[model samples]
Target: MAYPIIFLLFLSLPFSSAKLNLDYYKATCPDFENIVKENVFIKQTAVSATAPGLLRLFFNDCITDGCDASILIASSAYNRHPERDANPNLSLSGDAFDIISKIKNNLELVCPGVVSCSDIVAQATRDLVKMVGGPYYKVRLGRKDSKVSDAKRVDVNLPTTKMTMDQIIEKFTAKKFTIREMVALNGAHTIGFTHCKEFSDRIYPKVDVTMHPKLAAGLRRVCQNYTVDTSMVAFNDMSSPNTFDNAYYKNILKGLGLMTSDYLLSVDPRTRPIVEEYAKDQQAFFVDFAKAMEKVSVLGVKTGNKGEVRNRCDQFNNNIPE
Candidate 1:
């Protein structure tokens, strides 16, 4: 009896560890990643914002309840409020959700009920970064989609654009991200656009002295009557709005950062060094960003039998009672 119990424990060790790995789907779905990449390319070319949008989707998904695709869940009859309706997540591009759904549909055609939406979202994020000329890192798969999502949890876990560097650092650090990793992850801003309303406070009434005078003037022109036309937008990284590189950090160094949180990365004594380092070395930034992304992608991940692979990206498994 003792020997049998010890053998059972040994057999459970792999699942007990709960670590994700590159070959998670090797036996079950060999063509899984290629399919995700093809779908990403299709969505990305159709919409220029798709790349950054998907990347943002990955971050938001992970920060809340790990990268379990809870953010993709829509409100159902049982749960009237979902994470998607959260204030912080309100600005997420709808195209990202559509792209993930399309990819999940494609995967089901070939490997039905095998690839989880969580894994598909993770793979799409890596493909999107590579599509945008960023580092292509190996993603550990095997994440299961969450069956539950709450709006209140989103507000507690995510940092807003208006947060100070200390607040942002605290949030990321709580997730086991280092100060350096926090700074590197913020580099995702290199490729996205922000509405004028998100940053008008930095310029109106009194321009933030941290902003470069000329950059402030340019933003003022672009965001004229920002109070009335909140829809006006600007590139997060003015120099390389479409590229994923150290240009975002360079912008911060030059006082051209579009958000208060972004500008504070350079002004804060704790994060300034990492900002300056990444500003100077593109490769270094890429390496650290990839590591940080990989680490964050698996935070609080649910594996094994803890969650289920949803056939539809936007809804929970129908068989499971709400």
Candidate 2:
């Protein structure tokens, strides 16, 4: 059950986007480096577990409204501004930054001021998924950096570390993703870690006790070894932890889910039947996942002269009159 919970939440609830030509990308884009900086910062923090979640956040934002750089900028300075605050949990992990640094170095040497960092952010996501073993759905590229970052929108759009199945459904459906797509997306969690602060509810208060009694005990056994505020609970679909695969559905059938969203798959009527079907066949999950990802990837790209291809992922309008 713990495994299944994680599977559902991870694969089913994580991310979403869409398509375009090269010319359309350049007109409405922002600097690619800044996006990398933000991605690096987010992946480094305790909220590092949120890398996948944040990926979805930006994707959704890009698709919903045009790839406005302001979408990622701060309107007002809060205690921890969106521009400055690394998610509390997975701060400064260096994993994402290391990758971004490599990409930036190569891009600096090769393309120089040609590629967009917004595209880099999108590419990093693709690279990470490939490294982890998921299908490499084509990223439409050419996303301009958004200057409008809204904290309230962050709360409204991003899935919490602790989210219910219903919450997940509502979020994905808004983007035109079907219930089956949500189930498959949960598979992404197969590779990441969950902090105790996020999943501790299962053990401390004893909500759904269907999990292995030893599971919680095992968690506590090494939980202290990790972050004082965290538990390095790995996702259950470990075989293809990084690879996007149907194994997550198979794991769900065996009751290997990790979180509330993961475990609820068997109970939720909308997703339950699909989980059952997917559990039996990996191909089905893969095919459906590709379709869903395709739907999400093409969200708000500037295909018809709406935006520009950002030379730098983080900066916008390098030649603007300042």
State the lDDT of candidate 2 residue by residue for 236-284, as single tens digits. 5545543456676666555556666777876788888988887787677
Angstrom error of the Cα, residue 262, model 1: value is 1.5
RMSD of each: 4.4, 9.9
TM-score of each: 0.91, 0.69
TM-score of 2: 0.69
Instruction: Give the candidate number with the greatest lDDT.
Output: 1
Candidate 2, which segments miss by more than 4 Å at Cα? 1-19, 22-80, 83-93, 205-207, 224-233, 236-243, 302-322
Q: lDDT of each model, Cα atoms only?
A: 0.85, 0.53
- What is the C-alpha lDDT profile of model 1 across 171-271, one tens digit per residue? 98888788999988999999979888888888887898988889889998999876786567888877777788889988888888988888788888999
